[model samples]
Target: MITVFAEAGYEVDRHFDDGVVMLGFDIDPTRRSQAVMEAREHRAEARSMAELLTPSSVAVIGASREWGTVGHALLEHLIDGGFTGTVYAVNPEAFELHGIISHASLTEVPEQVDLAVIAVPHEQVDAVVDDCARAGVRGLLVATAGYADDGGDGLARQRALVHKARAHGMRVVGPASLGLVNTDPAVRLNASMAPGLPERGALSLFSQSAGLGVLLYASARRRAGSACPR
Candidate 1:
């Protein structure tokens, strides 16, 4: 099957199995180099779309105000980082978790969510992913552990969870990631283990750990602050 986009041009890549054929696109330019560049651009665009439309976001599937809990710090990090979007915390057992409106399930969020950060139990990860998919969430950042990292059935479960996410057209970032931060809105949405927020400027840093990201931000902030000596 061939699908042509108005501005992007035609599909040139394909995969076939049984009676199903997958389609790809060709970048126009009539040159190999330009074609590759265009193809890369298309791939990037697809990625950016996935990230941007991640719908509503939450810190933990069962967050609370308890110390050392995902619930207590999730909202705090968002507020500290200045996340100005729709943020919710999911904890069915609790009426309100950490002063934020809590929902028993992602379905109760009342709005379409493109992404969710699941800190639920390992066993609950799959069900949570299923719920997110059913709720139309396209991106998932799972911070749960107890998977293959231990080297056993845990690994198998983790792999299976990833496959389940893929089947649902959802992108999973990590099974053991610290989380992420968005500098555009001056927000840090990752785990509290992060260092600290960076100074405001044209540059942004993407780090693997909240601590590291914050550290980098601090460095940048210091540098920026120092550059303008009053």
Candidate 2:
């Protein structure tokens, strides 16, 4: 897979119009698995995010008891996913969410925080980002949509945020991402639709379209079920 990516990366470098520049994964396989492992660890470190910033802790900036809200779903899903992290639901004028204590601000949290999941409205996102950065949050996942994808004013504001986040050394994944899933650690970080991924296996799937990804997952499951293994 890495070799395929390397070829794709070189191809990307040949043209300036290739959408996003592709960076090849560089890992020395000659030193055995150690080099590969270290490379992965470094990538993991840059993306350590939620786990790195919060140390078994989480702060949801838009938490609510209301059903079906992003905040609600995130909290519920994290619990169901067996996240051992402590979750702090932050909402001013609200004391609790689903029976757990809720803080009014990230600064109110007693100890250092590692992650902040933002699901607030687009207008409130900048403030949330500023708050998280001030709180020294290591990782932030923004679940709120309606950014530049909507065009017009939204695009300008989203661009401002892109600059702000880069300045703060804070990592922001999406204003439009479907989130991510790493079942290896029993972790499902994205709040998007779960594709009913396999719990244990060496299987890995990547797709640009969410619908196609799920369809392929179903096909793979069917093939694996009916075919005989060597």
Candidate 3:
């Protein structure tokens, strides 16, 4: 299947058995090589999407104390989902969240951070991206909105975001993304605002709309007999 995409001139990256595929196109021949390099990083390695999917350690850049905020909810869900890896919280003003010590910034974290789930506001995303790139973080899951979806300047910002991350050989999920979940028993990473974990299975879901993603996940969970908890 990946070959099909490559044959058709699309830069296909990943095609998993569960029906998940990642593909893109490079209009410029000069940038194709760089795109391939980026694809290799996204394939799986120390600095790649593997970390985002099955990271050794994750730092929630916008971790928060407020119960209703996306940052707090994602952190709670990630911990509650039983990810067997190190979790760090980053909040400049707070020293701790959910019982773990918090750092003032991504760079402040003592050890390397493979993936960073950013839930900060749209205005501060560039600065966070800079820190993530400087820290050599592998993948980024940006749950904040106001990017390409907003059109005009927002679209330009979104384009720049990807360009910047790609230049650093880092992968980004979304500028207005909901997040990702891997129900694999060995790596149960849930870095989103979705409440309760869906039962582990073969199904892999993706959606452009967060509202619909929630609906689909909820429905899937109910069908699997592991209904989402309120």
Q: List the residue pairs that clash in candidate 3.
A: none
lDDT per residue for candidate 3 within 1-230, as digits (tens), equals 65654654455555465686555556454455567667766665544445578888989989998989989988888888887788999999998899899999988899999889999998999999999999989789998889878989999999999999999988899987878888777878888777666787667777877778878887888788554321
TM-score: model 3 vs. ground truth: 0.76
Local accuracy by lDDT, each model: 0.64, 0.65, 0.82
Worst 10-residue lDDT window, candidate 2: 7-16
Best TM-score goes to which candidate?
A: 3
Where in model 1 is the C-alpha error above 4 Å? 1-38, 49-59, 186-192, 201-230
The count of backbone overlaps in candidate 3 is 0
**At residue 62, what lDDT does model 2 achieve?**
86
Please list the residue runs of candidate 3 whose C-alpha ends up more than 4 Å from where it truly belongs after superposition. Answer: 1-49, 225-230
Clashes of each: 18, 2, 0
Q: Compose the digit string of candidate 2's lDDT tens values, residues 71-189.
A: 77776665565555577889886887876888988889887767677888988999999988898886677778787677888788878877888798877766654444444453433
Winner on lDDT (2 vs 3): 3
User: What would the C-alpha RMSD of candidate 2 be, to one decimal place?
Assistant: 11.6
What's the residue-level lDDT of 196 in candidate 3? 61
Model 2 misplacement above 4 A: 1-55, 185-198, 203-230
